[model samples]
Target: MKIFTARLRQTQFEISAANLAQCPPEQGVEIAFAGRSNSGKSSALNTLVDHGGLARTSKTPGRTQLINFFRMDDNCKLVDLPGYGYAKVPEKMKLEWQAHMGEYLEQRQCLAGLILVMDVRHPLKDFDRMMLEWSQHQNMPVHILLSKSDKLKRGPAKNSVLGVRKEIKAYGDQVTAQLFSSHNKEGVEQAREVLANWFGFEKEYETAQ
Candidate 1:
């Protein structure tokens, strides 16, 4: 399958939204990347786009505090959502972030799908389940990335993928998953294929082939 070799390479940071009203115009398709803090969400995004600094990677968890938008083209965009389930922040601030996230997920008209990143060793945390349930309720499709797979043995990494696939089966076929490791470029093509399909770029990729 074709990777994000063309269109996605053009992604550029567009806006950062702290609340729903601050979001850009609700136009075109957008797929959101979300996971718990320190789950390697930003790294996975940079890997997918083949841009080292496209999405900032921080050593501190919960550094991405706003909903950041990246424009791929006129018809497609990618959203880097604030990570959930970090305790370093104030409870009130966490609650406010949760509220804004909920509002965006439930009310965003342009959302086409969700990319749920999870650390390979700790897949499916409580917040991950909550996100899956919410997406299922919204009838939105989800693609899960088991990030940081390079830290695990091959057998364990495969097992983790299987375990997550089984766990997410309750949400139906709308939720699909694969192993990923930004450090070693593992599963980058597979993740890109999913994103391309979600954004209706499969035909373009096929045509290019």
Candidate 2:
């Protein structure tokens, strides 16, 4: 497998719908991450690129309100979507976010796949399950990344991964599952391998392609 040399070249952020609306259309392979608030999504992104603080890491939930795009290379983009499950936000705002995210996922033409990050301890919550269903319905490739696996014992991490994979298989075969831990650097290479496969993929995908 090829190791991405330029992991992440730069990162920029926003906090508004209008700003996200202005995003440059994806011209190359794009892998986006979506997950619940405080789920260590940012940490996992940092781990993928071996760069801390490129995307803000925080204890506060729902800090990211816009679709943040990080440039990985000239041909690809690593997307960090806003976290859901925010309670302090207003009800109307929540509805708008739902619509916004739905629209983006439903129609993002260059999106090669989605990396759904979840806390290994928590695995798939209610919202995560729904997103799984959504991806299944769209026939999009979805990788369930069990993030923060360092919190679990080794045996527990393996069990958590197996359980998540089993449950997601019920949803569809489009799902691929793996364990991850930013602290331990577990699954970093695995994630990269999967993304590279997708990035280089063409229609009627086969490993040969």
Q: Which prediction has the highest lDDT against the true structure?
A: 1
Per residue, candidate 2 scores C-alpha lDDT tens digits across 1-209 of: 43343544243342234344666765877788899987888888877777788777677888777777777666777778778897997888777777788878888888878899998888789989889888888888998889988888899999989888878878778899999889889999888777767777333245445
Worst 10 residues of 1 by lDDT: 1-10
Native-vs-model 1 lDDT? 0.92
Residues 104-201 of candidate 1: C-alpha lDDT, one tens digit per residue? 99999999999999999999999999999999999999999999999999999999999999988999999999999999999998888888888878
Clashing pairs in 1: none
Candidate 1: C-alpha RMSD after superposition: 1.7
TM-score of model number 2:
0.87
